[model samples]
Target: MMQNHEEHDHHENGSELSEMQLRVRALETVLAEKGYIDPAAIDVIIEAYETKVGPHNGARVVAKAWSDPVFKQALLANASEAIVALGLMNRVGDHLIAVENTPRQHNMIVCTLCSCYPWEVLGLPPVWYKSAPYRSRAVNDPRGVLADFGVALPADTAIRVWDSTAETRFMVLPMRPAGTEGWSEERLATLVTRDSMVGTGLPKNPKDA
Candidate 1:
């Protein structure tokens, strides 16, 4: 009887998964039929984001900045140019701005109107970042949103929320974790996370890394 129940549960789970895939395919078909989206173009974009471009690029940028104060200064001064120095200037990165999170100030990014993310640097925007609740709350109540993401800041810490637009996008430069004064850029890059760049989470601790 237990074996039969387990088999039935597995079948149900697989059925649900297939159903979700079908729904996604149907949506894609409808969008394509209406000429609102090109399936081939989408495939290319997805492949680029998933493989050629991603958080690794952003991580490298962060690592370099963390290790070099001069580069960090240049980054804060002209983020778009600084990132171009790292070869991530094309595709939704025409105007990029880097906001630093300090001891007294926290930074977060949101696109209330649309999901205008820094795909060139951070790759795809996470599902949560594109959600209605996060969009509304990230601007309306940033501290509360951070708390929901399990990011606790001091009561005196000021939360700064940056709204992204079609023309400009923002990336959060999270504070470097302590106790790793001589770490290599390659090692430090591993500590930087997608969420940390998006301002929803912090960098991985050295021990955790």
Candidate 2:
């Protein structure tokens, strides 16, 4: 009976893997036929993930932290449970933490060991994010790296650099941009960019662009 159960489990796993491959192949075929997928279409996919599969988990947390002081405290104290409380615990690994960036202290995240991230919330890390130069320089010279990204901080502001190891991953809770008071959550989410979450850029106001 034990051997039979093992075989059944293996079969089910193989079937699921096959289905995933088929879906990937279909997507590749569509991309090939189009010659190039629109960047806006990628945004649409990201939006769908945020709505359906919950890709904007970190963004939602940031928004909540902005509005609620208690939750923000909890997030700072224990990010893994705080995020799980927000219904974002379906991802693969554990050890997810949130770092907040304030006016006085700016926080940046980098994985020197590997490209570890909170993908359930932030989606895929950009190509530059995973590049060796970014990983190496971000921790050694954060101000210089941010300068390269065109993000300038005041001389009084202190930059806190967090290194993500093999076990724990980090995300940045960006300071809410100015001039976006009394906005709905949906509208606020539009301002939260991947770069902002990665601590490379600030959230852009609708009026700015």
Candidate 3:
């Protein structure tokens, strides 16, 4: 069976894409053609950097914080400044906040109004993050939302949901897992996941990684 000319170029398979995503794809196609880049490679590049598909920058921050106490303190006190020092600042937002998770408490972020995220750290916000259901449920039933992501916190640990505004954005600094005590920052960063910083998942255990 031979594919039609139109079908050969079409990527969507009866799936609906938001107008923004569609526009991004259009722009991506134009740029790739102009630069003589492969279209498939474009998707991988966008997923790794443009979209919130990877923990490239935030993983470094989380890993460093886990290894360096002084840096951790500075990051907690002023996220925007700390990341800027590491040259990770990329116009994420007007303000950036780092929230730490502890044995007694967990922090989750949500933009009830819109998706205001630390793009440089976490890449862009995920589609789900911008959805009405997530924006509403994240605040109303944070534990349930975490559960949906397969993260079950201890009953004793309190869950705190932070609402992100256009002027401010928040990122979760998940507690380091045990058995990773002596891990190097590079190795530890491999354990950090995009969802962990988003507050919906935990870093991978050393054994798992």
lDDT of each: 0.77, 0.71, 0.78
Ranking by lDDT: 3, 1, 2
> Pairs clashing in candidate 2?
none
**Candidates 1 and 3: which is better by TM-score?**
1
Better by lDDT, candidate 3 or 1: 3
- Per-residue accuracy of model 1 over 1-209 as CA lDDT, tens digit each: 00111211111222222477579889999999999999989867765655255444888889999999999998998888987776644433567889999998888887643235786788777657878999777766777888898898888888777777556688999999998799999999999988999899999999988
Candidate 1 runs further than 4 Å off: 1-56, 88-92, 112-115
**Model 3: number of clashes?**
0
Q: Which candidate is the best by lDDT?
A: 3
TM-scores, each model vs. reference = 0.74, 0.69, 0.73
Model 1 backbone overlap count = 0
Q: How many residue pairs clash in each candidate?
A: 0, 0, 0
Question: RMSD per prediction, one decimal?
Answer: 14.1, 11.6, 12.3
How does candidate 2 fare on TM-score? Answer: 0.69
After superposition, candidate 3 runs with Cα above 4 Å error? 1-55, 90-92, 112-115
Positional deviation of residue 72's Cα in model 3 after best superposition, in angstroms: 0.2
